[model samples]
Target: MKKFKKFLIWLVGIILVVLIAGAAYLHFSAYQPSTAANQAVKVAAEDNQETFFKAKQNKLTVIFYPGALVTPNSYAIWAKKVAQAGYTVKIVHFPLNMAFFKVKAADKVVNSNENYVVGGHSLGGAMAARYAHQSDNPHLKGIFFLGAYPDEKGRLDQKKLDVLSITASRDGVLNWSKYRQGKKYLPKTTEYYQIKGGNHGGFGSYGQQKGDRKATISNGRQQTIIAKKLIAWLRKIK
Candidate 1:
């Protein structure tokens, strides 16, 4: 009997160690903002650790979630560009830097008086779509994804919300098969854009990510293209 107890204790200890090591890997694997993106963080406003970038507040707001293992500040450059075009943007900071942990976190950021949209990059975008699919918030007008798409459960074929999907021609990190399958989940009115020569990491100011294809275009050029697309989408939301 004593031997069995000892074995049980040993097994529990090994499981704990493995869990701790896995957590540490996730922490260390987070993508950090580049110097320029880091510097831009200074202008951002904070609400309970969530970051906001609004040069001029407007009737429309965008709530963004970071991709898995991506720091929120990594998206400051993109947020700034959208904000400059007269929209308020809030970037959610997730526990463990993963958006799936807080799929409906956008609820706290929405205002009944303002028209709103939710979006994100990579896995963040998927989680945002999950929230959008299940939410009944009347203020939600649209959703935009950056190199990401919804899973089966986030179906929006009958939803009234507008959808915009932006992808990179050179992106190797995104699952193309899943992207194709995700088309059935989007509304009939969904719009799509692809950035030529851009890679997955170019969507944000973070440096190249592991397992992503090399981008043939400069980050500035890629960002500009994304900004233009976002601005054009925003203009149509009214």
Candidate 2:
């Protein structure tokens, strides 16, 4: 019995060590934002909220969550593009650069008086869906996903929400099985698009992801396509 107790203690210690190491890696290896994109749109930072604003009033506001381990600024280019098209974009910073740590972080940026959409990439998308599914925010009209899916726990299909799910054609890092299973949880009217030649990391301007497939198209092209589609979808919202 003493030997068994010793083994159990050793196993717990090993698990704790592994968890700590993984957390450290995630902290140190987080993506850094690029400075090459010209600041044509109004970029403002407030606490964890990074806003790319246009001059238009009554514009639809989009609150975006970054993928796990990706810095919120990595999505600035896309946000700026959307802003240039006359909509307001806000990229939310998650605690520890992981959305799972703060699933309702979108609440901080949402304006209850304005029309809005909530979305994210990868794990961020899952948490965004979780927030939309659980929250009673009447301003939220839609959900967007980039190489992501709704969390199974929330089952967004039950809610009367519009959804747009965009996936990459050659995404090596996305879990196909879970993505397939997640479709059942989305509404029947969900608009789905697969960007040909795009990869998992193409949604943001961050450097190449470790396990992601190489994108066949340039990041600029991918971002342009995403912005165009998103803008079109927002216009369709009544």
- Evaluated with lDDT, which candidate comes out highest? 1
Q: Given candidate 2, what's the lDDT at residue 142?
A: 90
lDDT, candidate 1, 173-225, per-residue tens: 99999999999999988999999999999999899998899999998888889
Candidate number achieving the greatest TM-score relative to the actual structure: 1
- If scored against the real structure, what TM-score would every candidate get? 0.93, 0.86
Looking at candidate 1, what is the lDDT of residue 12? Answer: 100
Model 1 sits at a Cα RMSD from the real structure of: 1.8
Off by over 4 Å in 1: 1-10
Off by over 4 Å in 2: 1-24, 37-42, 51-55
Span of 10 residues, lowest total lDDT, candidate 2: 36-45
* Candidate 2 lDDT, 49-79, residue by residue in tens: 5544553664788888889998877777777
